[model samples]
Target chain A: MLIEMLIDLTLACGVVLLSCLSLSAQRVFTAIVLYVSLGLLTTMIWARLNAWDVAIAEAAIGAGLTGALLLVAWRRLCDETAAQPEA
Target chain B: MFTKLEFRKREANRRELPPFAVYALGFVVIVLSVALMFSVVVSGKAAPKLAGLAAEKLEASGVENPVTAVLLNFRSYDTLLEIAVLLIVAIAVLPARSSNAAGVAHFCSADKQDVLNPVLAALLRWLVPLAILVGGYLLWTGAYSPGGAFQAGAVIAGAGVALSLAGRHEFLWHTTAARIVINLGLFVFIAVALSNALLTGTTLQYPVDYAGMLILVVEIAATVSIAAILLLLFTELKAMVDAPREGRQ
Candidate 1:
């Protein structure tokens, strides 16, 4: 019962942190960081829920691959912005 | 003294900060405090029952590995759609122009030279094959082990990246072989699911005797597709790396 409560508390805190980060982050890189952290925390939630398969997929595809993709996109966007001149 | 004071005032006037910083800091502090409180106050004894339930139900699904059962049996349809989504994203995001054809000649001519030290090459010679063997073993044993399609695919892709970096294999940004491999997993997954539905009167339900074979086949296909996708992404990044050089030339 205590373990359950802890898991629930962790999940609730994770969700709140993720939401706050998502709303408060000013930069795209920071947003991606928050998103990936959220993914990791959600994976923990899934593990707590006894869904190890979903947890693994969440960690791998959700956090890892998606983070990579976002970073790549961020780099491309920054490059494009840097190449542009103020009129 | 008046001039110095004026200069100091000017410096202070120029040192402006964003107005949102204070609010953002306050928010962060609040969140951290909440997280601390939860961690301190919450206990850790409520998850075992769920784990036990999962163990019981998953074993009854005829899969020895609970994760495998969850991925391939309990939620097979989701896996099917996930592969489809991956294929769609790969197609939509990858550029139409063939980077392979454009850069192949340059890549081949640049350096046939071995860039690595002989000692590293010898070590990699042993390590690469061993890694491949382990990856294959992981895929084969996924039915009863912690290993699975994604983990094995990542391992194989890591080897591919290493080999390409070592100059053993040319980086092909877009190739027919790659395209085919990328789509083959989704194709096989859909076809198998459809066939199962048609023959068995239920979706994704293989014959009892053929369950292992079907799982293995799907895993192999997923592994290939995943490896192809990752390799392609890396090649695209490499193309970006060479873009500046090409511009200079």
Candidate 2:
């Protein structure tokens, strides 16, 4: 029971901290990276909740595919003359 | 009098936060969220849900996997509508002048094959088939496992997407073949619906003995279509990205 509680606490704190960092980060890329981590953490939470189907979908589509799409879009935006290529 | 350095340090120490009103708003949000969470945790019931009902009725659904039976048999209408919605959304948000990028299909010049091409090509040559294999297994196993058409489709689409991003103009990405492939899922799904209605005398109802095989067939077609559709979208985006470079030259 104590171990389960510790695991849950660690995951919960990680999620909350990652989310807050993603939201408050000044650099857009940093936020995007943080968001990907947050998605992954949520996937872990889904597994912990015993929703295997939700966990699979979240990991594959939410984190993997969506993060790739977001990064691709970000790269495209950077290529555009107007957008600043933030580090 | 305070030194100039002390004055600068004092100014640096002062950090601005959102007003008290914002914290008040945060307090409200926190309270509401906590209350909602409490209700969800407290409202747990010991009664069985539809899992028992579905399990009891599973044999009739013609699939060993309860999840698959629920998705492709008992609640097929939901899946049908979901795929239909996906198709419509794909069409509705299609890129303008999509064919303008058709020239990209032939952009694979010998000079362009850099150090990355051989490496990427080697990897893709190895991986795309693996992806297809995995997707096929997932579709086949849907009759007995957690894998299903949607998951399989996503896996296949992931391979197609990786290839599409490689920026190789050799692939028939924006061609008529691509369009047809993209529509294959809708065509097969509708064919099943129509055939079942005409032959079985009911809509979306499969013959008991052939239900598993028929669903598998639909899943395979959906996987192909999904892969093609995702590739099409990615190709369009790549074209947009490539446009400026072409214009500059």
TM-score of 1: 0.63
Q: What local lDDT score does residue B224 receive in model 1, on the 0 to 100 scale?
A: 81
> DockQ numbers for every candidate?
0.10, 0.29
Chain B TM-score per candidate, please.
0.75, 0.78
lDDT of 2: 0.73
Q: Write the per-residue lDDT of candidate 2 for residues B159-203, one digit (tens) a residue.
A: 867766665533454456656776788788889989999999987
The chain A TM-scores for the candidates, taken one by one, are 0.88, 0.88
TM-score result, candidate 2: 0.81
- How would you encode candidate 1's per-residue C-alpha lDDT over B1-249 as one tens digit per residue? 111211122235436645587578789999999998798678644567755776877645556887777777768888888778877767755655656455344322324564777887897798778867766877777788667887676666656656665655665435556677889888888888888999899989777667777888888998888766765665565456446546856
lDDT of 1 by residue, A1-87 (tens): 999898799798987889788767878789889998998898888888876656765776677666765675566556545565433
Per-candidate clashes come to: 7, 0
Evaluated on chain A only, model 1 obtains a TM-score of: 0.88
Q: What is the lDDT of residue B65 in candidate 1?
A: 89
